[model samples]
Target chain A: MEIALLLIVGGVVVGTFGSLLGLGGGVLLVPLLTLGFNLPLREAVGVSLVCVIVTSGASASVFLDRGVANLRLGMALELFTAIGALLGGTIAFLLDERLVAGLFALVLIYAATTMLRLKPAASEDVATPTGEGPTGAPAPAGRLMAGLSGPNYRVRAPIAGATGGVFAGTLSAILGIGGGLVMVPLMHIAMGVPLRIATATSNLMIGVTASASAIVYLLRGGIDPYAAAPSAVGVFVGAAVGSRLAHRVDVRVLRVLFAGVLAWTAFLMLRRAAGLG
Target chain B: MSASRPGGTLEIRLAQLLRIGTYGAVILVGLGTALMVINGRSPLDVAPPLDPSRLVSDVLGGRPAGFIWLGVLLALATPTARVIAALRAFIRAGEREMTIVAGSILIVIALGVVAGTAGG
Candidate 1:
């Protein structure tokens, strides 16, 4: 009951703020379950995985209908992420909780810095149809579209998308950060995807990434169905509600607010890592 | 022509659907706000012992700043936010790969649950 109650509440936040800010619920939920509830680190991470699955799965359809998510890019990247997730989950089983926590804090700090420095710029509107590797040189031949730029910005996204997917999978299994914060910025700054598009697409990929590891957790018997059930239901409800309002709200403000929260969360995570809090 | 507009055309079709969704969302938001104001609601928290009520009050411009954090999540997690993101993707790239990816993730979730319980 306690887990369900807590997760249901958390579901609302994940469904709302995740879509609003382009992050996965895992980033917040893992830390909260571990520190606030005194759950074992691995178990907390396992639980966070379920939350991400529920919320993203329920909300992604709306994102799909609206066409905000870039499905092909996300999937092409997932083959890498799925591998990363398997490795990360294995590492979680091997790692010391303290080490994981410390890494978590460090990762959070990095994400915060990126968020703070994020510049609102024009969508490149350029599509590279080349199914090729990331190269430093110009996109070859018919693959080149318009480059997204500000004064010092031109991100090669396909490469970053693949790499970021691996990172998110690893983090999800290890520190339980979900890596959405990382994926969003990378997609925007490196891949040149629009912020909203990045966020939507990120959400789309999350369930798949989490599910990859979720199976591992289940096999290990880390999940508590009683807790995961109601929470998943709640997340579905919240995601439904959030999808309806995706357009009316101002997203930049939401980003600013979410970044602030993450900053604070980083502080808390650091404290927990140090056994100071 | 169905009932609400009685005039079948592109304009009415779009407008009617728009109004239903818009008004429905407003009512939902209003209902949530009213519940908070009138019923002494406790905002959602992933783990308690960390007052969400205060956070809600702070974020929504409600009294006492009771639940600022909760308000933040509530505002962020709406279906609207998710839809906007999804819509943007389709418009930008014209693909449904996201749907497959989400499905893949859920399978991992099931695995995690089974593993956690067995391990626990």
Candidate 2:
């Protein structure tokens, strides 16, 4: 009973912040379940994925409607990400959960470090559009680039987007945090998408991307509906509220706090792995 | 090291500092994993709590950690795209910069790989 309440409360916290910062909040979810609720890593990851997908879906919808998310750009990139995800998902089906956790900790460390060092500031004018036709208007012209690839649909720009998605898909399946960690950066740099747009797009796609792998896990009986249900409920609420308030918050400070939490979690995970807990 | 070009030396030092900081963070996490292994501790989180959902995990005893990293990267692609879009929005501010973002994320992935393996 207490655990049930705890899940909701935990979900509220994770969802709310998750929405606000656009974080997968899976980082928060994993430790909360494992350390606080005593769930096995596998179960925790499964539950975490379900919650993450719901929240991401809700958030993504908002961004998509806003026209900030480029469907052509995203879909084009998904080509590579989908393949990468398939391979990664297959690997996940074949690996152990603890090692997954350890890798997660390491990824957090990497993410936080990257976050600290990475300057989202654009360094060049690569966005100079040719003909500058549609200012502040939706240009379906992006669709034209999809087929302009090198011999045939091998366009370099589209490949960058695909690469981003491919990596994001693989990471989501393996880590359960939905792979926004990989997506945000790759899209920003490789594909030349704006950071804000990339995050919004990534959050939007997480549900579908996660669901794709989730299907595999479900078929294999990896999903526990009970755990997924409550988690989904909690995170969905959190994500909704978080998205509404995202712009109002101080992003830099929130990120710092998030990074700190990740570092601390890594410490705890290490302690647990070493039996120090 | 240069007395004449104080600002230039400082800029060089800052770049060096950030890179070192990035690697140092990775190394610390790696060492922790090494310590755990040396202590004969296992890496699996076998039976996580029931309330937290036991659905999607890879089960440590029988799986590889690389799969997890790969999954994380893929699932995050879209949201990461938004974040990049957000970053790229700064391009409108007139100083577009993707290098720092890319470099930072790459460092994280590389570091993540290092620490993840040590614990495994």
Candidate 3:
């Protein structure tokens, strides 16, 4: 009873933070399960992956509705991400758990450091005014359609997106973190996608990518349905709330706090990897 | 070319499908969890191994844990459905490239499910 309650509350908190920050809750959930609950890393990861799916399912729809997510780009990128997830999921069972922890810690540290950087200029600078619009915001003109809306943004360099997808998918599977931490940056910085569009599109792809690996976890006996159920439910509710609150909050403040949390999580993961936790 | 609308018809449908699927799954999982707690069965650290056949049997057998698993299965299926929705939308739009992309993703997901079931 106590464990079930704890997992549900923990998942809600993680999901709120993740949705606010454009992450998918796995980054926080993995460390929480492993360090706070003292579950095995593999089991923790399985639970985290489930949470990621819930977050994706809960949040991506809103993003797509708002016209912030480019579904066409997401679908194109998912092919690579799914392929990478397959390779990573297959390799996960063969690798040492400690190595996985170490890699996850490194990713956390890298993410935190990157978050300290200012917003990318590409989001604001590349304003090719295709037509006049309200607020004088240049309407993006392109043939790359997203759903029924005619064109979203013109996607460039499919090869670059694919390459990034490979890395994102591998990390997502092995570390049980949503690949968005990497994909958002890759799209925004490397592929010249707008930040909002990048995050939303990343959200859209996460479920498919996680599902690719989650199937392996489910079949391989890594998932604990008991742990995952409450967590997933909590995340689903929390993501809905967080998505509503996202616009009101100051993102910079959240970023700073999240970076601190990431740093601390990295330290805890490293400690566990060293057999000290 | 600029977008003709705020959200395309396909995007709206996808959003609606996802919202319904996820929220419904949450309700089912919540009910199942309540049942478990009421029955004095705690799923704390137990990882029950189940195949699809066993899952059906258990659910039909009035097992609360089965409902939980079913909820998860429903949640997982949403993504697959989304891919199919995208494929249909793309084909309708005459986006041959995008239709192929969605189709490829569906194939990958199918392969994963097959391999996972086989391995288990």
- After superposition, the stretches of candidate 1 with alpha carbons farther than 4 Å from their true spots are A1-6, A122-136, A140-157, B1-120
Model 1 residue A249 lDDT score: 75
Which candidate number maximizes lDDT? 3
Count of backbone collisions within predicted model 3 = 4
Quote the lDDT for A132 in model 3.
37
Comparing 1 with 2 on lDDT, the higher-scoring candidate is 1
Task: Give DockQ: model 3.
Answer: 0.65
Question: Could you estimate the TM-score for every candidate?
Answer: 0.64, 0.61, 0.90
Worst 10 residues of 3 chain A by lDDT: A145-154
- In angstroms, how far off is A161's CA in candidate 1? 2.7
DockQ of 1: 0.08
lDDT of 3 at B71: 80
CAPRI tier for the interface of model 3: medium
- The C-alpha RMSD in Å for every predicted model, in order, reads 11.6, 17.6, 4.3
In candidate 2, stretches whose alpha carbon ends up further than 4 angstroms from where it belongs are A120-157, A275-277, B1-120
* Whole-model lDDT per candidate: 0.55, 0.53, 0.78
User: Proportion of native contacts found in each model?
Assistant: 0.12, 0.00, 0.67
Candidate 2 lDDT over A180-275, as tens digits, reads 777766765555555566666567556545655554454444554434444555676677678777656766677777778778888777666665
State which candidate has the highest TM-score. Answer: 3
Worst 10 contiguous positions by lDDT, candidate 3 chain B: B1-10
